[model samples]
Target chain A: MARMSTPPRGRPGRPVDPEIDSRVLSAALEVYSEVGWAGFTMNAVARRGGVGKAALYRRWPTRQDLFAAAINSLRTSGPVEITGSLYRDLTQTANRLINRFLGPHGMASIRALVDAKIYPDELGEALDYVRQSTIIGGRKIVLAAVDSGELPPDVSPSLIMDALAGTLVHRILLIPDTRRAQLAANPEPLVAQVVDLVLRGVGWQGTVSTRRTESGSGEPRTASEG
Target chain B: MARMSTPPRGRPGRPVDPEIDSRVLSAALEVYSEVGWAGFTMNAVARRGGVGKAALYRRWPTRQDLFAAAINSLRTSGPVEITGSLYRDLTQTANRLINRFLGPHGMASIRALVDAKIYPDELGEALDYVRQSTIIGGRKIVLAAVDSGELPPDVSPSLIMDALAGTLVHRILLIPDTRRAQLAANPEPLVAQVVDLVLRGVGWQGTVSTRRTESGSGEPRTASEG
Candidate 1:
C-alpha cells in the first residue's frame, strides 16, 4: 500500500510527539515478533499502537524504515563497554548478545531479517547495518587486544570476529529448541569456551598459558576450563 | 486441506512409478524455492508436477511429508570422506558445503527450514535431519583427528565443529552479496583460513607448526595464514 506522496516539511507540519513515536516503535516490534517480515505491515503497527495510519506513515515512509527503527530500539538497551581484559570483555559482550538473541523480540527481528534476504536491496542494507554495528563493534575489542599485545600482531580481527559471532549465531539458528533453551539458561560456559578458542587461535601468550599452569593437575582440562 | 483418512496399504495398491515419484519431488523443490514455506502447498506442487491431486496426496499424505522427501532428495549428492590431515579434511568438507549452500536448491531449502522454526513439529523434524547429517558429518572428521592424536586429547569436537561450520555459514548468510561472491570465487583461501583457525584453537601441534616452518619467514603466522 502506498502512503501520501507529500513529504512532511519541518515548518509546515505539526511537531511529532516523542511519546507517540516510542509507542509506535514498541508496537512495531511486538507485531514483528508475532508475524515476522512476511506478515509485517504498517497498518497492523498503527492499529496496535493506537495511532492513525497517516501518523505511522509520516514517521516511517516504508516498512523497512519501521523495521530498522524497531531493531534499533531493541539494540539500544545494552551498551558494550570495554573492561580492559579481552577475555572478560568478550565473554560479557557475548553473554549480552546471546541473551538479546534468545529473547522473543530479538528472535523475531532475526527471523524477519533472514526471511528478508529474498528482497536484496532493502533487507540487505538493514542486515549490513546490524552486522557493522554489532559484529564489527565486537571486533573493536579484539583490535584493542592486538594493539596492547595481548594477542599476536599478526592476528586478524575480522576472522576472530567471524569465529566468535558466527559460532553463537549458528548454534542459535541451527540447533534444536531444547539445546537452545539450555543455552539460554546458562551461556557463561559456552561464552568462556568461545573466548578461550579465540585467544588460543590468535596465539595469545598471556592469560591462557597462566591459566593452563593453574589447572596443571594434568587430567586434560575441558575447552572451557581456562 | 485433508487428504484421504485411510492410510494406503502396501499389498492392495497399484505399483508406484519411480519416475513419477522423482518428478514430483523435483517439482516440489522448484515450487518451494519460488514461494517459500509460507506459500507452499500440495495443490501447487501437484499442478507444477502435472500430477493429479489424488495421486500426490496418496503418495505423500501431507505437505510436511513431501517437504521432507524433497529435502532428502537434495541431500543425496555427495558423501564426505576423511583424508587424514585435519586441515585438508576440514577444508574439503567446508568447500563442498559452501558450494552446495550457494547453489539455488540449497539456498531455497535453507530458507524454508529457517522459516519453518515457527511450525516447531513437522517442519522442525525435517530441519533436524538436515542439521544432523551435514553438521554432525563435519564433526566426525574432527573426531577422527582427535583419535589419531593430530589434535590434543582434550579438544572438544562439538566446540570445534561449531567454530568451523559457524564461521562459514555466518559469512554466507550474514555477509553481503559482494563478499559472498568473493568467497564463492575462491573458497580455498577462506577455507584454509578457517581450518587453520580451528586447528590452532584445538591446539593441534603437528602440520600447523611444520607449515609455519616451511614458510621460512621470521614473523609469526596469524590464524588466517596458510
Candidate 2:
C-alpha cells in the first residue's frame, strides 16, 4: 500500500522507481536534522540513503531543491478533521499543532527553516509553504464556521488564524522551558483562552456556555466579559 | 543635564565616566548592525568607538555581556506614551514597533538575538528582555483600559499582549516583502482590525463607535457584529 502511494521520479518521460525517491527524501530530512544547513551535503544524504550521489543530483540538482522536497514529505501528516463546534474544532487543532511544534522532529524542521532564512530567495518560498500549510490550513475551519453561520459574517479568518498561530509560536519561543512543560502537560486551558480571545475579537455571538463546556473546568474571569 | 542621567559603573568605585560608557555602547550597536553576530568582535567595537580594547574588556568581559548592554541601550528610545484612547495608544505603539522591526538597526539586532539562541542560556535571558520591553510594555495600555472600566474585567492582559505581539511578529516573519510593504505604507487599517478583534474578544461595552471614530475611514463590515 505504501509503495503504491509513492510518486515516480527522474525525467518526466523516463520510468524511475518511487521507492528510491522516497528513501532519498527521508534521508535528506535526517541529514538536515543532524548537521543542519551548515553541514548538510549531497554526499552525506546519498551515503545515508545508500544511493548514488548521481541519482540525487539527477533528481534534485540543488540543495534547495532537495530541502524543499524533504519539507514536502514532512507534510504527510493528516490535516485536522472539522468537528461541528468552532470552539471544539479550534482547541483540538491547537493542541495538535502545539504538540507537533514541540516534538523533536518538528523543532528540528523549524530550526532548519529558520536557518534557511539567511538565504533570501530560499527562505521566501520555504516560508510561503509553511504559512500556507499551517496558517491557511487553520483558517479553513474558521471559514467553514463563518459559512455555517456559527460565527459572525465580519469574522476575518486571516486575522483569527494569525492571532491563534502567532500566540502559539510566541509562547513556544519566549516562555521558559519549565512553563512550556507545564502548558504542554495540560494545553487545554491555554488553548481555550486563545480561542476565547480570538472569538471575542471577531465578535462571535455564541453562548458562553459552549466555551465553559468545552474547557472542562471553569476559572474565574480575569478581565471584563467579552 | 544629560550627565545627571548617567549611572555609576566599575567595581573599583572609580566612577567610570558615563560619556565613555555611552560611546562604547553606541559603537557596539554600529558594529553589530554592520557585521551581525558571526563577525561581531570586541576589537571591532573598540576600534569603532576609538577606545582601547582593554577599556572594552574592562567593562564587559564577554561578548554576550556587551551585546546585552547594547540591547539595553536600544531601549532608551522611550516607551509609548498613553494617549487616553486604547485604539490610538495601541495603533501608535504598533506602528512604532513595526517600523523598528522593519528598520535596518532593528533587523540587525533581532538577527543577532536569533543567532544568540544557539547558546541556550544567553538567548533565554536576551529573549526575556525583549519580551518584557516590547510585549509586556505594550500591554500596559490594555491594563489601564481595564482599570478605567473601558473594557471587561474578565479580559486577560497576558493573552491580549501575547496575541497582539505574536500576530505582529508572525506577519513580519511570514508575509512576503510586497505585502509587508503595503501594510507598512498604511498600517492603520491593519492596526484598527487587530484592535477591534482584541476589543470585541475582551467584551468591551463601548459603542463600536469608538473603533469607527478611531479607524478614521470605516469600511463596510464583512463579519457579524459583536
* Top-TM-score structure, candidate number: 1
The residue-by-residue lDDT of candidate 1 on A104-209, one tens digit each, is 6655655554555566765666656666666656767777677656878777777877888777766676767777787788888788888888777777766633
lDDT of 2 by residue, A1-226 (tens): 2422332222333328789988988889777765555557899999999999888888887777777677667666667777756777777777776776565444445454445444456545654665566655666676666655567656666777777777776666665655767877887788888878877677665654443223322333222111
Q: Candidate 2: global Cα-lDDT?
A: 0.64
How displaced is residue A165 in candidate 1, in Å? 1.0
Highest-scoring model, lDDT:
1
> Chain B TM per candidate, please?
0.74, 0.66
What's the TM-score of each model vs. the native?
0.76, 0.69
Query: Poorest 10 consecutive residues of model 1 chain A by lDDT?
Result: A1-10
Residue A100 accuracy (lDDT) in model 2: 66
Q: Candidates' DockQ values?
A: 0.34, 0.28
